[model samples]
Target chain A: MTNMALYKREMKGSIKLLVIFSAVITLYVSIIIGMYDPELMKTLDGFVEAMPELMASVGMKADAATLLGFMVSYLYGFILLIFPMLFCILRGNALIAKYVDKGSMALLTAAPVKRRTIAFTQMKVLVSGILLLILYSTILEFICAESGFPGELDITSLIMLNGGLLCLHLFIGSICFLSSCLFSDTKYSIGFGAGIPILMYVLQMLANVGGDAETAKYFTFFTLFHPDGIIAGESQAAVSSLILLAGAIILYALGIIIFDRKDLHL
Target chain B: MSIIKVERLVRDYGGGKGVFDVSFHVDQGEAFGFLGPNGAGKTTTIRHLMGFLKPASGECSINGLDCWRERDKVQANLGYIPGEISFFEDLSGTEFLKFIAEYRKIGIQNRREELLERFELDPRNKIKKMSKGMKQKLGIVAAFMHDPDILILDEPTSGLDPLMQNRFIDLIAEEKKHGKTILMSSHMFEEVERTCDRIGIIRKGRMVAVDAAASLRERHTRSYTVTLESESAAEAFAIDFNGMRKGLKVTVTTKQSLEEIFMNYYGGEKHDEHGAV
Candidate 1:
């Protein structure tokens, strides 16, 4: 189908917000990292041990017991997941729910486009916006690393970590898309969109802290893309990330199908 | 051929309210008006015809194609202006129009300039900055820009000034001349009387009447007020009028037109009391 028009329109409308958000996040992370002097082993040790708990809360891993590991864990665990999720929530809320809420869906549904085409185009815009944010964060990470912090910057591992994070974000985006299709109210869509990830994050944290419920970790995309898991060279996490990414694609497909068949009243 | 047909269409909003078993047809090149007061299911009927809402029972078809089953094809042949025209506030009017044009895959081809001049709209202004009437004008222009075979307008002139309303009527007339079918839903009786070839009056989720405007007026029971020179004369006239009545009912009273009563009680200079006296 000729769905590029909607995709282009959505992309143009959302890219500016994504850029501004990424810039703000990068600046904030840079300042936090700048305050650390990684040469102090005692201070570094304290930071590392504390970092794992923080990462765990943010749906990251607690296995990173070193400065670099802590930094990667924090970045991957909290910043990466939280930022893109916020992006997804905002974009997803606006995509379907906002149109329905504002009665603009009447106009769109009356046009020559199919409902599937509309959903797919919205997904394309969301995925593209998220990918751009990932790209910006990766570039910013490298720039921060080169700013002469006293730690060994493992560029390859960081790249892999961010790549995994991107996959997780894509999964979150799909979740948001599905939720958006399910809800007609934009506020409710956003609530569920952001809430689902946080719920998963909490579940993962509980699985970690509760010890016996580690199996629950497998249910979350965050668990699959944990930074410490990747740093420890655990192939399981990488495999799981791939599986979750596949799940994301399936969710997005389902969202489009549901949108197509369901009645859209405006 | 009928460009639009709705048969036993039932749409419920889950709260026990919506259009129920509504059936109507709009022939090719006809200006059809769906008229009702507020909460009369007019918008609901239009929404089903546009394929935005699926009927709970029965069907809606546009140009002989099922609206729900053959949506894309049906929609391609129609232009629609919704009741509420909210746009992406961040985009300029030019950008919004360009986006729609691209989607429709039709070049503006001087249509933009013509419509802009006709509506006095500035293409450069962001949608958020424009007034409600300006936005409505933009929607009207966008709906017509592609020059589709049918135009479905819901409350098209709600926010327009009298001048713009006249321009809108003229635009519809032009479309009619070009043989474009129109299905318009509105609450304004005068507009329906002025432009529609046929009208369907919906009340309480059912079509109460559908006929030519003149026929509707003729069918409606009208009230007549008759004033006599005196109360006794009024009583006598009332008895005579009742005996002579064909359809209209006449009420005889000492009541006078406010203007005439005012002229009698508060006499002023003829020029000052009434214009061009």
Candidate 2:
């Protein structure tokens, strides 16, 4: 549905940011992979024993002996999820909504290309960005894990963990992307686009406090991708992955449909 | 055949706003000027023709295709500069033009270069940094660079200095000479008078007058402010021509043209005498 020129242009516009995001994710994942200390792993259970509530509140695992447990608690639970989610919210809003609001989309719309073609092309940019980020971080972390732990790491489980994260980010990105198309003014669109994901992130955090708020975790999309569950090869990873994939497809289709029919006030 | 056609187009924006039952047509190789004051539905009408807005009741088309349904096909023949020019301000003008050309599939740079040189525009500067006139110049080049058959410009000369405005007028004249169809909306009477073969004046979302430029001008009455050597001479001249006299001066409004007729019908303040003028 899209011409090569448009796809290439969209890619060219964001390749710089893609490279920067990949580099940052790779660096963080590599540092986490290298931070596996077997000696520190044995004594780690004592801290959890001392203050179980405080440890759970901060998303710290009591048993951080194994490399997988350390990474699940130290990296995937917060930094990795939050970083990609932020990237998706920012870039997804910029991809469509900001362009339409600023009248730059007018320039593209005046051309021979269809609105769907423009949309699909930008979607490629977004999907490719997420894919490349995952690819870079996974490869870099794999190399670090192999050298640091030497065959002790379950490679398949690690791949599944990253895959779950990818699906989660795509779902988050699509929410922002859809919100961007829903309104003409940036104030409203940006409010919805950025607001929803941040709300979900906060809900997940409060849910982890493990009291009355524990049930609130069920409400957020984040509940699907439990870092420790993913590293342990739990069923939640597989189920959440499917749900995120379905939600992402629906939101993206809605974005294109609304964008095609809505009046461009520009 | 008409290159651009708008029929019974009504788009109510609420609170008594938006265009109402607007209808007009511009034939092939004809320049039609749409004249209206601020908020008089000129831009709305142009946007309809551009397929940017869907009418509430009626429809508009270019080259016989439905404006909304077949906009992609219709846009192939159209070149436009929106009322408010907006661009990718982060990119330099040259890059932005190149991006448009790439989308337009115009591999040749001659026309784009010629337009840049004609407008005295150096498209190397960032669009955010460019002055309004320069951005307007860039918009003109981007629109004309493709050499489209139809041009839809809304207030194309609003931000430009007078010299650039004249340059734009000359450009339109050249485009007109090439047998191109153009619909331009503007507040300036002289530019429309100079370039358009026919002119339509719209007021409050309603088209008040439409006529051939030559006939509209020839039939219009002229206004002359004459100074007399004597006070009695002024009063005598006023009496003779049905003009008004004040302190040795006689002010006589000209014959009513299509413009005067429009104003007269609306009973505006500037030209108050309806029957007398």
Candidate 3:
């Protein structure tokens, strides 16, 4: 179903970007975990009360009774979402659309390999990239929390939170991959691939602001991930994660089929 | 049986912009030249043979297998050099070749090494930093390294210097001698005249002519412009030679080279327009 040589080539080509993103995200996770002080939370609550709308709009809250809640409110709201989304958008576009747009796809297609195999290999590269990024942050979070405030974080809730985060990113990466496959031009691929996810993140933020803006969540895929609910180990979070995983599978499959059937102008 | 075949292949891109009712075949161990000017659907037709495209109507097959349905099987014994050569820019030339070898599961590196030396391509430099001619040489090496039975090359010598072009033409001639079936699309008449057994000239998505290379040259009548001292003398000379007279010039047709015949096919309508005026 996939070509291992192509998989290795793609993985090698994208490894630098993955490493850079992983390092940056893990750094952010460590810093956030390190800053999980109850005294600082009390002070932050004072500012949160002063600027409730502004803080809420960014998915930030100082109302945390545990280390995991503090981490979720600070990191999952923006840093975690934006960084990995950037990786997905850029890496996804580079995986397929970049080669086609630059006319290098002819080299691959000229080989005996099927188009389906090439697409499948690229998908594996992308999916693995997202997994590694999420996994790196998850491990770093554990290491940081255990060393800094041992036993302060709930093991089950933290696992559930990271699981939901993984599913959400996989879904976002698939959206980028589909758009990448749909357009033969990088500008258009990046435009829609990067555009849609960033839009969803903004909507998620606006929905978090509460009141009339709450309906905006319905329009965004990001709403499927409720960091607070996942941290509380809600069944709804698990179902939403499953839905995200399902959507990712469908989008990836559609991308592969479309690439196999489309006419390549290369 | 034909080693490669296209039966009434039609891919309409609309507004008369695509190949229409295009048909041709290459027998085993024959070199067929596909000649066309820019935007003449040369690459479009070749794309179908490579199975990168499905024809709107009709079909293309290689070794009796449908090109589109069994592309992988077809490509297994086929090599292709696309009109535009682009590569993985980040990889060094050596790395790209190794990658292709691994991708194709080629165990023997002898042919690849020989081609690299013949082309004088230093695979040490990153492809992004290499010159266009170097990249072209790399494309040629990668396409031929597998030593496939069928080779489809589009403008294979486009960016090469005259020396390298001659080398490529010689290479094609040698490959033809080895009984490789080659379908080469080119704009250069000299290379085709030197290497191809037959030539097919395509213009405006239609095959204007397909004939033996030697016959296309032999059958074409060359046009010459004879200058006289006066318009009367030119008119007198034109009548004697049964040529057209314009001022002090008398145009006569004699023997044409392959280049002129190709020009006639490509610019035939424009030439007729000028004659009408």
Candidate 4:
């Protein structure tokens, strides 16, 4: 189904990008976890009360007494979403569109491998990069929580949150991958690959504002990821995560199909 | 039997572009040269053979396997050098070759080393830093290293120096001698003349001429005027040349070079200044 040599080459090419993103996410995760305090929440609540609408728009919550709640409210909303989305966009475009655009794809297709195999292998590289990123953050978050505030974080909910985060990004990553497969030119690939996710993020922001704008959530896939809901033990969280996982699988399969069938100028 | 075959292959890119009803075949152990200008659909037809494209109207096959449907089987023992050479730029030339070897699942490194020496390519420098000729040499090495039976090269010597070009011509000749079937698209007439058994000239996506190289060379005809010592001598000279005799001057027709034969197919002598092909 996939070519291992091609997979390894792609991994080597993007490992640096994976490391840099993971490092930055680790830094933000630790700082946010380290800042968890009962008193600070009261002060932040006072600030949140002062500008409730503005606070809601950015997804910052006031009542974060529990460690998991504090982490979800602080990190999941903006920091986790933005960084991994950026990683997906860049990595996805680099995988297929860049190769085809630069004409190096000729080398890959020139071999005995099937186009389906090449696309599948590249899709694996993308999925693996996204998995490793979320996995690294999960491990780092566990380490930071255990060392700083012993037994403060709920182990299961934290795992659930990260799992949901992984699905969300996988879904996002597939969108970028599909765009990459759809266009042979990097310009158009980056345009749609970067554009669609950024639009969804904007819609998520507008929905977070919580007013007449709350209806906007229905339009964006980001609404399926509920870090706060997952921590609160909501059944909706499990359903949404499954939906996101399914979406990722479907998009990836579609990308492989399109790549196998489409004419490559390379 | 035909090892590579195309039958009425048509791929329409709209607005008077793309190959139209192009058909040709290379028999077992035969060397076929595809000649055309830059936009004459030479690369387009070759791309179809490599299975990077699907023909809209007709079918092409290799070893009785459909080029598009059974491409993996067809390409398994095929070697190809694309018109434009672009590699993983960050990798050293040696690293690129190794990756190709691994992808092709080649166990022996002897042929790769031999080709590296034959092409005089160091391949220690990064591909991005390598000169154009070096990159072209690298492409050639990669294509031939696998020891595939069928070779499809598109303008294989585009960036090589004169010396390297001759070396490449020799390589093709040797490969042909080894009974390897080859279909090479080239602009260099001398290279084709030396390597290919037959030549196909395409113009604006149409094959204008396809014949044995010897026959094409026989078609190389030009006229020359001879000033004889006397009218009687001129008349005698005109009889052999199939030309006219007028007093002391006789207009004689004779055979020209293969290059001129190609030029005649590409629409007459206005393009005399652009003579490299």
Candidate 5:
């Protein structure tokens, strides 16, 4: 019940940020598509050629070239990943470290609630908030698609893609939650939480560049949530995404267990 | 029956800090004060009682329910006001209070309104804009609004004005009359002296003494300032007073505590300068 309350609060606080980001990104993409209709194919070709480098940089897949693939790669790849990463870091940092930093945990912990309940509620709030953002972004994407910009994208496939992104966000959220448990300082929590995902993103890109190190893709969450893999209808990446999602749950559970036993100073 | 009990509760920080093997008990409906100097483990003990930190060894229980294992059930019966009041700055006082009430699964009802009025808190204001006293009042209101069976407060009056502190004392007195158990941790000796029935003094994380306030004062060395008609009488009384007790020290003084002089001067008066006798 406490978790439910915290989740509601997190969602309430972040809805505006999520809505604004979604509208801005969607509107920007729609305008670009409308103004440069003649150069659309040229731009699409350039985007495809740059896909590998872009994917390497952002830990996305290089194969998204078709209309559906372009939308997923352009919209979901860089924008979706960065936005949720920011949200997860912000939410996770606030949940535990912020409370400790501000001395509010003393007030909360002084209540009859257990430390584990507090930690668990925070994780729940963060994950739920990320889910809300994902839902909003997916709605925006659908709206933009319906407005006739990307005519060939399938709604069902887009839903599945968003679902995969949701799992990936959960993965990142758990990582951030774990970092929060490890670091009592808010600055350290945000730094470490945001740093790890970006570091993993870099690692995945390096592995892609090596080509022979294909197995390294399994190590990073970004590789699992790659837009091209989903658009290519590769069941393997879907399975990998599920595995990463499971890993996230396990990480969060581990954090909760540790937090339950650890002494809190607030 | 003891409403709160701690038996040799050890909470050691990795570097050998915090409370170590400290133990005490508070009977039901008792207003217990936990007195300690800074870093004397008062907050540490309170945290253990709240189940925020597990005891390194031994146990802490509330109404016979283990605080660690039965946390939610134990917490459901508790109202807590922390030493430091750090609320969600963006939320209005009412919003923050409502959020807490919702988590506790209770309706604010009239309790919220009553507390706000009593504390003179404006619930409409954002928490960030409120003064420290106002913030403290908000915390007090939130904690008390639930009307829990037990209140575990840590320096609850740190930021309150003297008038508000007096009101808080009266509130605690009222709560005590209604048979609510209170465990208050504070460095404010006078407040403890005024509000608590029993006082526990902890020094360096170990409980130095735990007894009824009057009894502890009596058992410990009492200070008596005697002002005689002459210096000879004052010197004679000091020697006699010192000889009567093993460790007692007596001092002859020309000056008296203003409170003592005021009481003596106003004795048996029907009307006083302040309009009360």
Candidate 6:
């Protein structure tokens, strides 16, 4: 059984952040929907023909002028990746490292619960916030599409895209949370928590730089969730899902192990 | 039985900066004051007792449970106030108190409300907006609201106003009467003298001395100047009392004073100067 008091406090503290993140994603989806003018896809096709390298540099497909491809490049490609990843990195740090650095965690650790219990409850809150963010964005995307661009979206692809994103962010959050649990100093926690994720993003970007760069994809977690393949119904869900689940599990386990045994030095 | 027991605890942070072979005990219903200069291992020893630090050697226990391994069970009967108080700044004072209460699982808030009123703390203000003294008051309320049997307070009156400090002294006295075990670390000699049954002084990560409060007070000697009738009378009075005679005045000092012993024990500057010489 979990601690209800801790759960409630964690929820209350992060609810405002949760709302803001969800709003950004939803608003972004709506704006992208507004960009659709039915014939704009043809215009995009012409523009892509004019400068193939411009679209290719950002990993946008030259032929993706349909609703699904437009959403993939404009919405998922940048906004979803940057905002949610930043949210997870920052919130994950705040949950553990910030408390320890500010000495507020000393009060919580002095309570009757074991340190692992506190760490576990905070981890759950992080996961719950990510899940809720994805849920709200997915729902709003559906609503925005139906109202503004009815019959434009492919339902399966939309679900697949959100599902893949959910897995990816969980993987990101777990790594950040683990670093937070391992170090009592915020500098060390942030150095690893934010540092590693940004590195992975860069590796993925460099892998997309046209030629021999594609080999770098193998070194990044981004290769696990392929957006282009996901939209084309060519994604290997079992393999990607397993990697994400395993990464999340191992990282969270490491966090609990370290937090439970390590001295907080309060 | 001892409510808190620390035995030969050693935590070496290197550069001679950690507690070394420290040992002490606090019995139930006794007030023990821990006195020290800054970085005298007082906080480290207390952290060991609070189960916040895992000792490099030796161990600490509370109510017969190991402090580090059995912290969850040990904390049930303990109340603690750290040297520096930090709260969730976004929450109001009332919200923070309520959060502590819920964590403590107290169905009735009779004691909580009583402490709030006693401290005159308006709990509606956000924690970030509260002054240092008010924040210290909030820490006091949260620690005592649980009404635990043992209290570990570090520099508990540091930021308090004079009146509030007196009120806090009175509160400690009341708790002592109710058979509470308290281990308080402080720099205020007056407060320590007023409330503690025993005192321990630490210097440079080591305990210098521990003695009963009454005995220590008795050991502390003060020189008195007595104006005699004349120089001859002053000399005669000095002979009678074995005092120092200076014209019409005679001076006498108590022997084997605790303050003298304590001062000598924490003489780091003297040690450094001697080394220099």
lDDT digits (tens) for residues B178-214 of candidate 1: 8999999887667876789998877657776788977
lDDT tens digits, residue span B53-76, model 2 = 778888898999998888888888
- Model 2 residue B190 lDDT? 73
Give the interface RMSD of each candidate. Answer: 1.4, 1.3, 0.7, 0.8, 2.2, 1.0
Give the winner by TM-score: 2 or 5: 2
Candidate 3 Cα outliers beyond 4 Å, as residue runs: B221-268, B271-277
lDDT of 5 at B203: 58
TM-score of each: 0.83, 0.89, 0.91, 0.92, 0.83, 0.90
Query: What is the model-wide C-alpha lDDT for candidate 5?
Result: 0.75
Model 5 clash number: 1
Error of 1 at B87 (Å): 1.5
lDDT of 4 by residue, A45-149 (tens): 887899887777778888876888888778888888998899899999999999999989999988889989999999999999989988888899999999999
Against the true structure, whose DockQ is highest? 6
Top lDDT model: 4
Better of 1 and 2 by TM-score: 2
lDDT of 2: 0.81
Best by TM-score: 4
Clash pairs for candidate 1: none
Clash pairs detected, candidate 3: B222-B254
Which 10-residue span in candidate 3 chain B carries the lowest summed lDDT?
A: B268-277
For candidate 1 chain A, which ten residues in a row score worst on lDDT?
A: A35-44
Clashing pairs in 2: B220-B257, B221-B254, B221-B255, B221-B256, B222-B254, B222-B255, B223-B254
lDDT (tens digit, per residue) of candidate 6 on A104-167 = 9888888788888888988998888888888888888888888987898888888988888888
- Scored against the native two-chain complex, candidate 6 gets a DockQ of 0.80
Kept native contacts, fraction for each prediction: 0.85, 0.64, 0.87, 0.81, 0.64, 0.83
Candidate models: Cα lDDT each: 0.76, 0.81, 0.87, 0.88, 0.75, 0.82
